[model samples]
Target: MGADDKTQNNAEKLGGKVQEGLGKATGNKDMEAEGQKDQSKADLKNAGENIKDAFKGK
Candidate 1:
């Protein structure tokens, strides 16, 4: 994947982790779930980018 996309995805994943940690510390189930969802979305985007790169023989 391109550098910018990769960086953005990484940042998103990191932010999600922070959110999850905060939620756990504060006993907020909704925030934790949302954080997990954000991480999943970032992961999916990375997977899609990888697939595109593979198809392009990168």
Candidate 2:
């Protein structure tokens, strides 16, 4: 993936982590679930980028 996309995905993952921490601290199930979802989505995107990079021999 391009640098910008990678950066954005990383940022998203970090944000998700922070959100998850906050949710846990606040005892919010819904927020925790949402944060987990966000993290999963970012991970999926990063995996896709890794596959693309592998194909390109980067």
Candidate 3:
């Protein structure tokens, strides 16, 4: 993956983690679910980037 893409994905994952933690602490199920969804999306994007890089032999 490109450096920018990696950084963005990491940031997204971190944000999601923070959101999830806050939701759990405050007993907000919706926030927790949203956080989980965000994390999942970031993960999927990361995976796609990895696959692309592998195919390109980078």
Give me the candidate number with maximum lDDT. 3
What tens-digit string does per-residue lDDT give for candidate 3 at 1-58? 3879988998999999999999999999999999998899999989988998899899
Which lDDT tens digits does candidate 1 get at residues 1-58? Answer: 3668978998999899989999999999999988898899899988988888889888
Higher-lDDT candidate of 2 and 3: 3
Better of 2 and 3 by TM-score: 3
TM-score of 3: 0.93
lDDT of 2 by residue, 1-58 (tens): 3677888999999999989988999999888888899999999999988888889889
**What TM-score would you give candidate 2 relative to the actual structure?**
0.92
Full-model lDDT, candidate 3:
0.91
What is the lDDT for 15 in model 3? 94
- Highest TM-score: give the candidate number: 3
User: How well does each candidate superpose onto the true structure, as a TM-score?
Assistant: 0.92, 0.92, 0.93
List residue ranges in candidate 1 displaced over 4 A: none
TM-score of 1: 0.92
